[model samples]
Target chain A: MPKLDNYRVPLKGPVHLADYDPAATPFAHGTVKAQEKDLKMLNKQLAQLMRPLQGENKRSVLLVLQGMDTSGKDGTVRGVFKTTGPQGLRMATFKSPSKEELSHDYLWRCHAVAPAKGEIGIWNRSHYEDVLVPLVNRWITPQIAKQRYAQINDFERLLAENGTTVLKCMLHISKDEQRVRLQERIDVPEKRWKFSLDDLTVRKQWEAYQQAYEDLLEATSTTHAPWYVVPADNKLHRNLMVNTLLNHCLLDMQPQYPVDYPELVGLQVE
Target chain B: MPKLDNYRVPLKGPVHLADYDPAATPFAHGTVKAQEKDLKMLNKQLAQLMRPLQGENKRSVLLVLQGMDTSGKDGTVRGVFKTTGPQGLRMATFKSPSKEELSHDYLWRCHAVAPAKGEIGIWNRSHYEDVLVPLVNRWITPQIAKQRYAQINDFERLLAENGTTVLKCMLHISKDEQRVRLQERIDVPEKRWKFSLDDLTVRKQWEAYQQAYEDLLEATSTTHAPWYVVPADNKLHRNLMVNTLLNHCLLDMQPQYPVDYPELVGLQVE
Candidate 1:
């Protein structure tokens, strides 16, 4: 319902800490707790719609979730989809391609896990990594990596053409906020296992990754597959935004119930 | 642990409902209260595992859930994995295949959504439907279809060998108990959605399906792929049994803090 295109993050290339504004925007008011409650109700209704789709045996959905570290993607999945009937959902999280996967094309591993008709397939972090991580870490040369970006666009486009409703989300969190979370993990005894120094190394390159993300969103947020930039500084807001976006998608799709079972005629006990 | 082999449903095919004494194992002692408490704890821990795995640029998991219509499969996933970190855990329920999938091998649709590494993949009903459903209904001739029983065994064997950790559970509820639940669904206002008049038609063939399940389990449960018959008559016991089984699996897998992080150096941050 909101302007999906207007939510892009600005880029001055790479900004120093002095250029960072900790208070800027600070996640929009009323998007957090207020939307969360609404999202839960919407999800219950949405579940009913998604349920019979599986039974129809004809169509399915592909939900792609992308976000920064500690952006609460997991929480969103738990809170929003916690009530959906499991019969119609399939989730896949792509990491670095395995030794076997790397032996093939980047999209090969992704192809192996696409959802079937009458199902919902989810990607936690998908082939976008083929662009985002390599660009941020200089793992690939720019010229070839740019080509990879185009390949990704075409790949997602093909999936969409074939009936996969692509819902891509970018969970946007500020650098300082991520630092706050990383430190909290270090400080809390129960959460200590979650901490590692490598987290800080990623934090150091935060601005560059943000720019890369901004660029990725601009290039790939096409009519068929648009990116929804969820203001994720507040975990609650991130979940609400995600729920709102997905609720919108399901409404738009308006998936219907399967035909009643002819096999059940006069079968009920009076 | 409990003798793994002895814990299973007996091999000669399921004994008649009247034969087994419910009072002999009414519920594992304290398993009920422990379930209420353990579910909260399990949900929290699973949430933690899901957070980073969702963001990690590597492996995903596919979880398959299957049970009788009201065998508490949906409720178990909702309660136990309620707080499951959303990023990596995806639920997919299988029904009849599409024209495209029915045109191919039965495994075609299932392979399309198998979980990638490091993610928890859930299946509500998997390819095992070929063995269970078809075998019960005489939908396919027993000669060709009974062969599929062995094929499914090998297919699951391949999955577990490939790190999928295939866990198959049969929610064993008694016939009288199921009738009571079916009646409750019809009589209760809130539970009306859960009842399908069609289910009574299926219930008429329950004894046949039970025999099919028993025969299938006997022929299929291998060392790599074992089946857990969680006494599901009691909902709390079912949840606790599932949690214990899964917790044991994760702890055994020993997913760890990466050893290479330079942060492990002597800062004494804690």
Candidate 2:
């Protein structure tokens, strides 16, 4: 069951994080104990599609991830939201900004934590780190990183015309698997508070952040937010390819459960 | 291992929510499959003490919970944080208070999501429902519910003198177990969007919300935030007594990890 349209990323491209093969496992099929028992049966079918996507509070999903430093993105969000528990999950990490989140407009702190309306939202490192750290520290300008990739594809096409689904990934790893995960986070003294000397000056700009992630994965692969590219050097095939691309985007958003409640169908709670 | 100081709530006197026995499973010792294998080994040792309490960013833990209306507080936060996944967990959920959270105060949207530092916050129906739905609908007075239980014990002793470690819980179910969980959420059509005919007008003011939870568990049981009545009608002994009182307050806050990086000790990541 591999065709995640062969790791997407092709909206008419010139994108080459050197033709992707971060130790490829094309959506792993069998053994690593059967892709961790199919990532615990797609993390209990993403905790049963996050309870009718938070009891059908209309719609929202987000995801986003992106990667590189230890290319696991907090181990694919703790192995694909280990049973979607932090109730309707909202996790937003985006570090390196605060001064009142650089006084706005950097998608204003990723649109002030986006996923609402029955939430799932998980960014971790996003708003594509404002065009990959100001276009790999030339502090912006490749025409302001192509106008922040058409203003992040017009702010993810206004969150997919207001019902939000989004889902992006990148995780791709290698450059000798990030020098063996930044030298096992400096010989693992409980992973030395996730090592930094600016992660060895961003691992000496590993080929300029892989050419600023192949020019923002070829200017933000769009059709209302599409990205993929996740081979992530097998941390269980990057948490079984981002939990099978977020259980194929919540089984194509079949989130229901909001039963109209015909006058509480023979009501009685006395 | 029952003595969580015999279900805590004692910082001085009279808190009889009928002396707590909502189907008591004194922290359920054996078999319900060995207390669901000791709640999956205390949810993997509380996800390994949430990575050194988020790499010792310097203490924090909140919790809160409170109860009634099918007293399971989202199934004890989906069974004791089903393996702490939403990175360093923050939760929140308060519910009724808008018009800009009833124009401030009522612990101003719970001191704007309190747990910062090395996070673990979770409220789920808190600021003790601003003193239980305005002192059980008399809508304030009882001297502003005794000045909001001494301003929620000086706002949880200013989040326990700023390093935060609160811990509240109250879950204690049984008005015939909330009439068999509100009649299995009205005979379950995918639990009919969690049925609410204002949950039967708060189940006909259940003894004035159990005498406003026996006067806020006898005036906010303190010693800088303590309160635990938790019998909770055996939903696996209310998730093994709030995951064994949050793994005994993260093993008495033994959160360490920030190893003062000695100039990257023989450092080399190139």
Tell me the deviation in Å of residue B21 in model 1.
6.1
Go through the candidates in order and give each one's DockQ.
0.20, 0.29
Q: What is the lDDT for A13 in model 2?
A: 65
Question: Candidate 2 residues A1-270, lDDT tens each?
Answer: 678877888888688877888898877886788888988999998898889888888898898898878898998899999877899888889888889888888898888789898888999899888788778889877898898899889989998899988989989888887888888888888888887778778778888888888888888888789898988898888888888888888898899988777898787776
User: In model 1 chain A, where is the ten-residue run with the lowest total lDDT?
Assistant: A9-18
| TM-score against truth, every candidate | 0.69, 0.37
For all predictions, the C-alpha RMSD in Å is: 6.4, 20.8
lDDT of 1 by residue, A80-147 (tens): 67767344566676756889988999899898788888777778788888888888998887786778
Cα RMSD of predicted structure 1 = 6.4
Superposition error at B183 for model 1 (Å): 10
